[model samples]
Target: MDQKLTRQAASRVPRPLAQALSVVEEAAQGTKLWCGVTAALACLGGRRGRRAGTAGLAAVAVAQLVSNGMCKPLADRPRPPKGWIPHDEVEDRPDSSSFPSGHTAAAVAFAAAAAPAWPLVGALCAVPAAVVAVERVQSGAHYPSDVAAGAVIGLGAAWFTRRSPRLLRRCTSRPSP
Candidate 1:
């Protein structure tokens, strides 16, 4: 597939930004740091961290399932060739649909869920968010709006999950132990 003119234009991300994105991608994809970061954020809830853990888990679960399983397939977006990813810098590549970036969704959802618990750490969430957003566009995997929407979806899912405990308890309620 031919590269979108927009993607080709956006691929001009600076060298330093590209390097920074590489580092962020490495962190997010390797060692499940996203999960670890969320777990640590849950810890900030003090005794409530345990409870928050459950909610955080639910948030992350919903986000991943929605982004990777449902949205990505439905959208059927394309990815840039191996070299086209700014750092990768490819020439000819197959075109895929560019909508609703999964990486962005996952990263944003995690940030939204954990940010409430650990405000300081929550700030770091943007690092991955930015990295994934840039990486997806730079790689021709997605358009800018695709990533924006994904962020909205992911963050919205996390927000709903965080706020739904009352609903969850109401549904899961049982006789007091």
Candidate 2:
């Protein structure tokens, strides 16, 4: 299934779209795109930007940690086979497990985390985040399952970050067992 899907994507996607996806992929490497957005928010967004930026970054960090540090090391899956991807960039795919996509993870985490604090900014962020997810598969760096898992991890991280304070309050408020 992954092979056939990748083959169709490689053949069917337009050249301009492929190029655009490459740009998005490069910007997303190691969350550089997100850092730039967060910086802009913190600088020009006033108090609301600061809150959203902080929350977004925190969630991204957690998502990256869980996706890259823990999950990648445990899962032994690899990048798509070379013949499946008819792109030159296939050679650039990382030699690591592709069970989850760190880029997608960070993107979703940032968008999800920021949405509650700044709805407009979060909506804007979601566009690129969605692009990042597609780029992961279109680039042949990950299968669709990898992107899905990464998105799940990202959402989980965002949820945890958003809820941790309240959860802590609940835990602390409880009487000694």
**Stretches of candidate 1 exceeding 4 Å from the true structure:** 1-5, 39-57, 80-97, 171-177
Q: Which regions in candidate 2 have their CA more than 4 angstroms from the true location? A: none
Candidate with best lDDT: 2
Clashing pairs in 2: none
**CA lDDT of each candidate?**
0.65, 0.91
Residue-level lDDT of model 2, residues 53-155, one tens digit each, is 9899999999999999999999979888888887787788889999889999999999999999999999999999999888888878899889999999999
Tens digits of lDDT, candidate 1, 143-172: 667778778888887888887877788878
State the local distance difference test value for candidate 1: 0.65
TM-score of 2: 0.95
Number of the top-ranking candidate, with TM-score as the measure = 2
TM-score list, all predictions: 0.72, 0.95
Q: What is the lDDT of residue 176 in candidate 1?
A: 69
